[model samples]
Target chain A: MRGAVRALIALGSATAVWLGLLHLLFMADLDDFFGGDSGLRPGAASLAARHVKMWSEPTLKELELKKMRQSNAEWDFMGRTFLVLALANMSLRDPGSADKYVDVIDRIIDETIKIEAEHGVYYFLMPYARERPFMAKSGRSIFVDGEIALMLAARRIVRESDEYATLLEQRLDSMVHQMKDSPVMCSESYPDECWMFCNAVGMAALRMSDVLDGTDHSEFISDWLASIKRNLVDSDTGMLISSFSVDGQAFDGPEGSSIWMVAHCLDLVDPEFARDQYCRARQELGRSVLGFGYAREWPRSWQSPADVDSGPIIPVLEMSAGSSGMAVLGAASFEDREFLLGLMTSLKFAGFPVRRDGELKFCASNQVGDAVLLYAMVQGPVWASVKRRWNEAHVSSVGWVDKSVPVAAAGEL
Target chain B: MRSDFFKLPRIDELLSPRGFLKRAAVLTVVFAVFHVAGLREMTSFLCGMAPMTGGAAKLSALMGLGYVVSYLGFIVIVPILVIASALLLVSSRIWPVKPRV
Candidate 1:
């Protein structure tokens, strides 16, 4: 009895202590992952400083790009795009530091556009993009067009550029024409395929364009929203499916990686519906255990195979690196402070953050991943600007201010 | 004949544990070595770092896996072990373990 009692004591004590103190290892706050009064958090500043340094220093930048290119050339380009975007948003938030960020942004934009012109669209795309030709008259990838447009739009949002205005409009016109031309109003990223991720991004670019140029694509956008309602959502999960054929067949189910940003982009298109999607996704994909929060790639009801985007789901927890990275967008988009805090803490715990000479990088994540984190920390103001523009446009319009209708806010899309 | 980490300890010894302290010290030293050796950078492959070229890719992956495991062990498991041990000591002092039969 004495021996048994001691054994129980040791076990019980250890359990209690671990249960109590294990969370301390991951203690962090939302402020560190978000903008405060100063418009830059410590982690965000370190990350931005590191990227700015990498861009200014060519050899280090090449080495980093080469590693990413070997995996996916898209990621290489995406790293540039995301960083440029983060810088643009940062510039808006931090006017004192705006000039430095704008310089880096312009350099990245010039280099990116030049590289695409030289190497062709295939340079940044995956091998499968070449497997079949695009369905449009011009062999353009929506993946390229959408992101580049957003980069341009974001830059112009910070400080309007005459050069970028033409560039943004040219890209948007072609995309709008192509999307409008399609029977289902979906533009292709891959051959005969349209992704919710890319479409949402394309939509965000459109919304941002309206913010900048006073152009209205409300009819086009609302129609696309109608199409989304009719065809894009998964019935089983009641969340939007990820990809579809140009003719509007569901290609993939609601995915965490896709939905978080989808919900975020929808904030520009429709705030109430965006809120609805976010709440539903929070119900399905979001997980909070003990104190740490994570997101799973698929809802329990959606039977799907793991794909590249899921990024090696942890065995039983079903956490996806891809989804979790994008979940930052969701949490930030909705101002889910508690979830954001928990997720950032989990990131600090798992992301293998290294700080040297005031530079921060997550060792367990690559350039694109780090860029996404930076964007998460500083995403609000850009979207806020878009919404403000949207509200301004609709303030005098009849019946537009009515919040009673879900579709009335952004005009149903 | 054998070393057993999980072996039960007498209540009096647990109150001011030496073995537990020794284990914590070892973990700290090992973590220090890992930190100094720059194993943390190698762990970048855990996310998705690709090796530069042909034959080196496999080798780089192996090194990444090794670094990541050790890094996790050092940061997570070792701390857990040390804390649990400390808790055992604290519990011993609180209850003043009665002599085992």
Candidate 2:
């Protein structure tokens, strides 16, 4: 009996020692993961440069191209957008090596334009696009037109390219005209379908137009702002609705998948409104625990089915791929360093294995997903430059326009 | 007769230390199966996002937690347990005592 007791004591002691050691090791690993001075570091360019070199090789390019072909064509288009935006941001951040990256970006922009012209806008859109005709004439989607125009504008801002300037102006004019014709100042990409994402893109295009042409559309911007504040924004949560009809009736409530990044884009045109939206979104949607951060697809009160926009909702936690990707933009824009780092840590550990060669391809995430991440990492400089110019002009032109009619037609007093 | 009786197999011999190691190995394999099958993704359901598809409804949250714990245990703890058990067995063997008749 005594021997048995001794044996039990010895076993218990050994178990305790092992567990204690394991706990120490686990804490150390976690500390290494979370302990960083800052979240927004300047290493994306180097990472992207490495990817560019890897992609420059014909064999690797062929392999990636083959995989993209098997998947959706939008992936192919989005890949170019991400790389171009990264390159543009890199050019501003680091001019010495900017030209090489700019050349690559220009090539992507040129190629993307060619593809859009050849295959038509339908090529990049989902199959549902064909299910119904667009409400607008010429069937141009604000989604495609706005993003493409932004890509071109970003390129031109980096280096004065006459070729892209013409394209940018044409696209901007079309978007502006579409916004003017709509009774509620909202353009539809589908039959009676308007999306917050597209609208944000349109706003971004307008902001870019203001940047490029020195023109002011403060009236038009303010009018839309008032409309959003009155009709589009959810009163309880202050988050913007994701979709609406042409007549400004809500189609979908505020969605986690869209609101966060839309808020980031909205920051360009209206910082106060954007910050308000972001703060509400963070309170309603963002979650953090045990030093990790994630977001839900919908608020607790609102229920919606899992669609392509949400992208494979994980049961129980309510994590959405789209929301998770967009959360990066929100966290970065708001300067929520802890949340950003936690999310980044989660991404590194969970969301598809990112290999060491800078070839970050998530298993569950498609090309557009990665592009959004790339955009989040490099979005600051472009918005910063635009804001700087706007601030400088504000002091000079105090009596420019009335605050009530923010949405004036381009060049209209 | 007394010596022959003493020659009988011991409990440690019957359940070899190496055999326990093998069981730990089996636990590790099972843990890996569930993890790669994306049972970890189900943990997201706890966050209130609906399941990706209908098939995920079958696994209860308790079952997922059990699988995750067991999986982590097998990968992390089992190896240490096996090593410690092996050391204990070897130590016992090195200091063997004679049974009184």
Candidate 3:
């Protein structure tokens, strides 16, 4: 009996010690591990290296994209958008690799546009997209139009591209026309579904376009923001509703999957509102325990069934892998280093990261997930460029139009 | 016949502290094998994507689940078991039990 008691005590003490050690390790300051804006981060560089290789190698790109498309066709399109944005930021952050990153960005834009041209708008959309006609007579998707335009605008911001300049304006004009036709100044991502995520992205794209070509969309952007504040704010959480109808009736409540990216995009249009939304979201959906952080797909006040966008939610913990991944963007965009550090710790602990030949990829995350993380790591420069150009424009003229360097004379990447 | 307590534990002594060490060692070896075999990449299935472009997704996911389980055991359990075994051994030495007369 005494021997058994001793053994039991040993087991108990061992467990306590192990838990204590884990706590100490996890609690250690991990700022350097996640990387900051000081220089090129190893993880980001490795991730970028893998993406550059993928864009350059069609066979490899198709293989990876095929896996994601098999699950969600939208991921195929989203992966391209996130990668393009990441590369653009990388170009701006590290000019030595600008040409290479610019080359990949242009390729992604060209291929995406070519595919849309050949396969039509429904190609990248989900099957439900074709089940009904769009509310707008134009029958276009803001999801596609906005993201593609954002990609183009991002590339041009990094390095002037006359080809992308023409393409960006055409896409923007068509998208704005569709949005203007709606009562709420919103466009559809699905048949009648006006997603806050896509509209906010559209607004950011428009803002970037104005910065680039000196076009004025301030009134339209402000009107859309007013409409959203008036109609789309969720009563319980004060977050912008995730989905709405053509007339701006809420279809879904505030969702982590949508709100994080929405907040990030809205920062370009309205920083104060964006920050408020982010703060609310951080309170409602974000969680941290034992030095790890994650985001729930929905707040307690707004429970949602796990969808493709939310990915799988771990029960009890209420952790949504999809939302937690995008939360990285929100945290990074807002410069919430404490929360970002905690999230990165959880990512390193659970994300199953693999490094091969100086290229990094997370085994628990697909291409789109990794791309989102990559974009978060290198996000600041593109948005800063837009802000800088807007400031320059304001200082020069009384309007939202800036007298910027011409495309040919715009400094090479 | 009297058996030495410190001798290699017999199969009947599987419940002893040394058994815990043996179990942990086995788990550590298994996790190492899985890691070296490149099964970590298969864990991409956790987020709902096929681990390979053309292979059977279910099979890939099963392999991924195997790696994950072993990995959890390795990271969380192996150390505890080893430490427990070590502590038990130390306690036994400090407070030796007299054999029954």
Evaluated with TM-score, which candidate comes out highest? 3
| Candidate 2 lDDT, B1-101, residue by residue in tens | 57765565554542445545656777888888877776654443322232232344445444555554765577456756576566557655775544656
| Interface RMSD after interface superposition, each candidate | 4.4, 9.1, 2.4
lDDT of 3 by residue, A1-413 (tens): 66667777887888888865653454524443345543567778888789889888889998899899889899999999999999888888788889988888888899999999999999999999988999888889999999999999999999898988999999999998998888888999999999999999999999999999999898899899998999899999999999999998888899998999999998888878999999999999999877788899898998778889888788999999999999999998888887888788778777888788999889999999999999998888888789767766663454433223343323222
lDDT (10s digit) by residue, model 1, range A1-413: 55345545654666566656665778776666685534788878988999999999999999889888877787888788779878988997899999999999999999999999999989989889989889887888788899999899999988989999999999999999999877778799888888888888899999899879988888889899998888888887778888888888877889997899889888788777888899999989999776778899999988676676776688789888888888987898788888887788778777878899999999878888899888888877777777766676765662344242344644643
Ranking by lDDT: 3, 1, 2
- TM-scores of chain A, one for each prediction: 0.93, 0.83, 0.92
Q: Is the docking of candidate 1 incorrect, acceptable, medium or high quality?
A: acceptable
lDDT of 2 by residue, A128-184 (tens): 778988888868887778778878877876787777888888998888788777877
Candidate 3 chain A lowest-lDDT run of ten: A404-413
lDDT of 3 by residue, B1-101 (tens): 56784577654254358788888998999999999998998998767677876558888888898999999889878888888988988877888866667
TM-score of predicted structure 2: 0.73
Q: Candidate 3 docking category?
A: medium
| Top DockQ model | 3
Look at candidate 1 and tell me the lDDT of residue A349: 79
A73 Cα displacement, candidate 2 (Å): 4.0
How good is the docking of model 1, as DockQ? Answer: 0.36
The residue pairs in collision within model 1 are none
